[model samples]
Target: MKETFEQLGKKGLIDILVVIDDSGSMTEEQKNLSTKMNSLLTSLKDTNWQIGIVTTTVQASDKCILTLVKSTDTDAEAKFAKAVQAGLSGSGNEEGIRQAVNGLKCSQSPWVRADSSVAVLIVSDEDNCSSRGADCPNSPGKTISYLTNYIEQTLAREIGKTAGIYGIFSPTVNSCKTAGNIGYQYEELMTYAAQKSGTTVSKIFGNICDADYSNTLNAISSNIALLLKNQFELSSAPDSGSLKLSVEGSVIPAANYKFSGKTITFNAGKEPANGKVLTAEYNVGAVPLFTKVTLKNTPAADTISVKVGSTVLAASAYTVSGNEITFKTQPASLAKIAVDYRVAAALKNAFQLEKTPIAGSLKVLVDGKAASGMTYDAAANQVVLNPAPLDGLAIELNYNYRTGPQLSYQVAIVQGAKNVKLYDGAKELSYT
Candidate 1:
């Protein structure tokens, strides 16, 4: 799972492009936007912003405004209201997304700022005719993907800039009398903007039929303001080399920010403002111990013991194969477990059988003579000669038994405190 963290910051410079559908049927909506200009202006009065207008028609004179009204202008609200009163005599074939893109391209001079965030408000009651077909036969055939790519690859590519494209159109087919096809392409564009900005589509869209535009406009402006954060805190410490940062939808160059520990601080004059989607992707540096463990040596039969913390575990609690021990159930985080075992090998005075021998199926000899006092230790699965043989004595032991080496392990569980316990066969020891 990815560890994520988010934060909202103060306002920043933004260029607002209001794309209005000036078709014949949009008279009432045009009046609505003009009358509700105060709601939009009041929300952005305190911001370092500018407003521009454009019509969804190919007519050269009806395309876009060359100049932008800055927030600093005393008559900014008046200028914006007048601009939104675009007349209802333009073409019926409304290509809002396409015209919005055109407006940005043709009016980059005084209308679009180099480093400011961009917000596109498409006020329409019709679906976008971005692609070629009956929807808009005379269209440029630019798809929704093309328009969004322009925003990401061209507009947002500027060092810390972002773009939020919102839709003020029909939400569902037949949801409103004048709406056409529910503005499917337009809604898709808004959804894309919301995703790149780390917001929900609901936050970036408004139903064109809404009685009042106050709430929706305010919410959109507020969310756009949050796209201005210059700093963010990560949920966990991340590997420095694994960090990858992106703002809006464009990848930010590594040199654009200073990532240290869990905090990321953008370089001077390089903060984002298009959307609230500033993300830092990285791998966590630390992890917890989970299940299996490896041993230093292979254990001999019947000599295995396991423990977690200070609690001894039964042989049924774990299984050992070669030098790896796998616990039946994973120990809790930070729980200490200890395992001890005797090394398996053929040694001097003792013979540990691979398996249990058949009852009375044994013989013993020392120096070519029948030897006595020999017994089997079931616990160790070993054959022992009582009082061990004299030095240099040729001893022989024969037995009918099964196959593998006799091995055993001891484990202990110790919880609480900051100590680890280990067993060395004869004694239990603790170390901090």
Candidate 2:
């Protein structure tokens, strides 16, 4: 089964991406998110919160304003407080959620953690037309459930699994009014997505036109607090039996931990204590390991042994075939090519020069003697001597010639024992 893993058994970051509609009608609503920022921060005061915001204006660089990072004194207050007031002309038909996902792909925030739970918050008063489709005037557009599923599926395909989708929109029919955009058909995706995330429709979806946003903001923050759980998923799957966990300096019993599928969860009372470091140790290597090797002949089954550098490995760990070594399960980490074969005939010439061009400064030596009366076609990159030298005669040609296709890693001299020599035309290369 595919599972997300952490390096050295360490967990990833906790990231939250927010999408705000900057339409003229959303002025007070956008300001509300900033005014209640403290409430959102207070809800997640326990962990490192990576928060970012983007507009639904369909701008090129709408992924985020990185300067608006929370929990830091780096001007996030100014940036986040007045983001919607930046005069970015937003499209009246705002596609906040869709635009947020698109912005994440184009201009990703640096704080986004690979192994973190991602939640997208859309603050809009319109229905979602994020997915490309035909006009919705004649026919009823896709329902909120279909759109929410599409969004989660996209997130799962792009950014691992998602925890929740929190949206603040006019969920009730005709509960709010917008100029020209009458009725509440605008943003039903909010309620649909809230339901898709296992949240009650009334719990996460908020009324867009509410004056005091304490209730809606509280709901959004509560769901975000629940979604942003600190759980480390192993980057590489490990043998469950070989796993051990610890909190601070105390080793925890296996009974305190619940391991199933590709992720491990701590028992209710066994969760990591506050300010305490939780670490795990396990043997991992879910992916097959491939290595380039050289064999004097066909590798014999009886004499095969696995050794990396000077470290002898378990005999049952690996298999050898001709020039390839495959490991059934790799270790916790892999380094550079450390098992290079000392017997490898390295720095050996591979291919012979088929055509060498001659020029004024070009020099040619045949059988260690200077040869003359040669004709060369510089444009064709080919040279011809008055009489071709015999096969046994040593030929040295120096000229500026056009390079050919890249050389392959493996080259075979099928019949000849003579070593091929490669030269830069000015000097010898890896081979002389």
Off by over 4 Å in 1: 1-9, 41-43, 60-67, 107-110, 130-133, 157-161, 229-432
Off by over 4 Å in 2: 1-13, 60-74, 86-88, 104-112, 129-147, 157-162, 178-187, 232-245, 253-269, 273-432
| lDDT tens readout by residue for model 2, 1-432 | 233223222122446667777766776777777676666555665555666777766554444443346655576566667763534367765655456555445455455544456666667765554322122332222334333444456445221234556666755554567522322433455455555566665666666677776777677666666654445555555664667777655777988766654456654556665556666777765444444444555543444555664576675666776656666665444543344333333222222446554236566687888866665655565455766664446767775554786554455566766766656687876832
Question: Best TM-score goes to which candidate?
Answer: 2
For residue 75, model 1's alpha carbon misses the true position, in angstroms, by 1.0
User: How do all models score by TM-score?
Assistant: 0.49, 0.53
Candidate 1 residue-wise lDDT at 92: 78
**CA lDDT, every prediction?**
0.71, 0.56
lDDT of 2: 0.56
